[model samples]
Target: MVELSGKSDPFQHSFPNAVFYIPALIVVSAVAFFGYKLYKSLTEKDRKREEKLKAKQAKKKK
Candidate 1:
């Protein structure tokens, strides 16, 4: 084994650009989750409105 060793790299302590991607990924995931929730709520509202309309028509027929 070689006994003589040089100094370690100076850039080892400096963070790379890839570290910034972690926060970006979290933000994207949060946006997607909220968007999905919005879509689900809108669809539920439409479904309830349709049900009310159908019940009104049925009552009129009877």
Candidate 2:
């Protein structure tokens, strides 16, 4: 016959550890998202500057 212990399942102990990591994961994700956005914004700004410079040069050539 198989024996079953009355104590809580071993898996239950890991639940708290899992929960504890949730906040850390969320914080890391948020930082990564913000960092990506900042990088994108900077890249866009640089592109716009390049376009402006090209336009100015074109005007001078005319």
Candidate 3:
């Protein structure tokens, strides 16, 4: 491995802002996706419960 001279440190390289923004964007997207999935699951359970109640009420009227 070639060593960089006196003032030049390998770790001192400048990274563009996009490098940092990319990971942040990915994390935000993943969180949003998971949140949506959880919301949909809860709503589905509620819908099923409502259907059962409606069916039971209809049977009582017969």
Candidate 4:
């Protein structure tokens, strides 16, 4: 015959879940910040390039 302990499952008492979530949250936050910065910089460059091309075209018509 086997007997079960009255205590809860062993996993419930193990290391806290925050140990994994905290580092993962930090990494994800860093990636998002850098990704947004890169996106803004690329878009700004494209906008400036487009404006220069338009100005050149307008000058040719005058």
Candidate 5:
């Protein structure tokens, strides 16, 4: 006689091991996006400052 009450199947109630990878991937992608945005903003600010300085120098030469 097979006993159904005492034995439990390992595959029937198993939790997924790779479930946390999804959130980790999302966090890493967000950090990369923010870092790229910061770099772009800083580069744009520096470029604008350079243009202003050049304009000032040209005015001084006039």
Candidate 6:
């Protein structure tokens, strides 16, 4: 490999290019986890509501 005197890269000693990778990955994963949890909670509430409505209807029919 041809080495340039002032060239910067991820493995270069002068500048750290890959430094932001880990923090960015962590932030994205955190957001995804919270989003998934919110979705699951919302769906669960809907499911419970539907179950209650069905039970109520059954009681009315009886």
> Best-fitting candidate, measured by TM-score?
3
Ranking by TM-score: 3, 6, 2, 1, 4, 5
Give candidate 3 misplaced runs (Cα > 4 Å). 1-12
Looking at candidate 6, the ten consecutive residues that score lowest on lDDT are: 1-10
For residue 46, model 6's alpha carbon misses the true position, in angstroms, by 0.5
Please identify model 5 stretches exceeding 4 Å from their true place. Answer: 1-13
All candidates: TM-score: 0.72, 0.72, 0.78, 0.71, 0.70, 0.74
* lDDT of every predicted structure (CA atoms): 0.83, 0.81, 0.85, 0.84, 0.81, 0.82
Best by lDDT: 3
What's the number of clashes in each of the models?
0, 0, 0, 0, 0, 0
Clashing pairs in 4: none
lDDT of 6: 0.82
Cα RMSD, model 2: 7.2
Cα RMSD of predicted structure 5: 7.5
1-62, model 2: which lDDT tens digit per residue? 22244356663222446665789999999999999999999999999999999999999999
RMSD of each: 7.9, 7.2, 5.6, 7.0, 7.5, 5.4
lDDT per residue for candidate 5 within 1-62, as digits (tens), equals: 22334346553443354566778899999999999999999999999999999999999999
TM-score result, candidate 2: 0.72
Better of 2 and 6 by lDDT: 6
Candidate that beats the other on lDDT, 3 or 5, i.e. the better one: 3
The C-alpha stretches of model 4 lying farther than 4 A from their native spots are 1-13
Better of 1 and 3 by lDDT: 3
Model 4, span 1-62: residue lDDT tens: 12244356663344567877889999999999999999999999999999999999999999
